[model samples]
Target: MSLVSQLKTLATRVGTEIKGLVRPDHPGLARAWVNFGYVGSAIQISSSHNVAGVARLAAGRYRVTFSTPFADTNYCWLAFARSNTNSNTQRMAIIRATTDTKTSAYVEVICATATGSLADTTEFNLMVFR
Candidate 1:
């Protein structure tokens, strides 16, 4: 092969590798994510990837199920939430529920008011990584 053709082939391969590394579907990146909230007392999933569904257990408590189960229960996760009116400060906790396996996560969203009680929010987001 000509030198120019060989260099072009090498450049294409390098570009493909870089793209794979940065793609959302990459094996080393996040496996699941969801943006959810309550709309008129019903759960609404605005957007998600690899998330099967979200269920509201009680006020400020929810369960997120993954479409594909992980190999084990060793994954890491992040959770965030905000108040409906955006007036109250919010704090969130991502937990492994007693019934959760490698395919689900449980989360709690609390509003930090003067009383410091657990309250539900308007929106919650979760991301899971393996």
Candidate 2:
């Protein structure tokens, strides 16, 4: 390729990459650049997270698969779940998320009501930072 043409192509690629790294507009995620969330039955990774994918392990539990796994168990991450419009109450506050110590391949988020019952398809969001 001509030198001018090569430079133009490199600039375009860099611009596109910078745009893709922008984070979601969530206050809680200010410190955590990674962002992924579920909307009803669908799960999607925001531009910031750059994750591999997400899967519903159960009603309230989700497995977030990462494109690049964290370096270790000490990786900082957060998870939160909210009840859908059909099911809203204080119980949603009891939702919780956690990861295992053996590996950083994936983080599992489990959401439950205060009564200890799994919330049905609850909306959940997760963020991780190394």
Candidate 3:
């Protein structure tokens, strides 16, 4: 084969190898992240687990329903975002309930202070990762 032809073939193989090395989302690899939470008014989901129900367990405590249980009680990590981002000093905690079958979240300072509190918010979203 011509010297030029051999060089071209070698270049093509190197380029292909480089492309494969740089592609992080290659089909053979599993995703590095997964969605496991929801935005609610009527309630919507973003996880592999299915939503079975939702309810207010108490004054400032809430529950989210998952049809199937999580692999481990401590595996879930959760966060929240309120629709009103104008201002706030309040905070929320979305965590796995002590009871495995029951999922709950705690919101502090709910309707406590008019400013920077849950009293001024309309909607919220939850984000979970395992």
Cα lDDT of candidate 1 equals 0.70
Candidate 1 structure quality by residue, lDDT tens digits, 1-130: 9999999999999999998778876657879888888678888999998888888766766777788777776778787777566565545653545654344343333333235555566678888887
- Residue range with the least summed lDDT across 10 consecutive positions in model 2: 93-102
* Candidate 2 similarity to native, TM-score: 0.55
Every candidate's lDDT: 0.70, 0.59, 0.42
Ranking by lDDT: 1, 2, 3
- Candidate no. 3 TM-score: 0.38
Best-fitting candidate, scored by TM-score: 1
TM-score of each: 0.68, 0.55, 0.38
How do the candidates rank by TM-score, highest first?
A: 1, 2, 3
- Residue 125, candidate 2: Cα error in Å is 1.4
Give the per-residue lDDT digits (tens) of candidate 3, residues 1-130: 9999999999999999988796754544322222222334333334433445444444334455555544554434444544344564554543434443432322111222334332322343443343
* Clash count (model 1, backbone only): 0
Could you give me the TM-score of model 1 versus the true structure? 0.68
What candidate 1 gets wrong by more than 4 Å, as runs, is 1-17, 20-28, 94-116
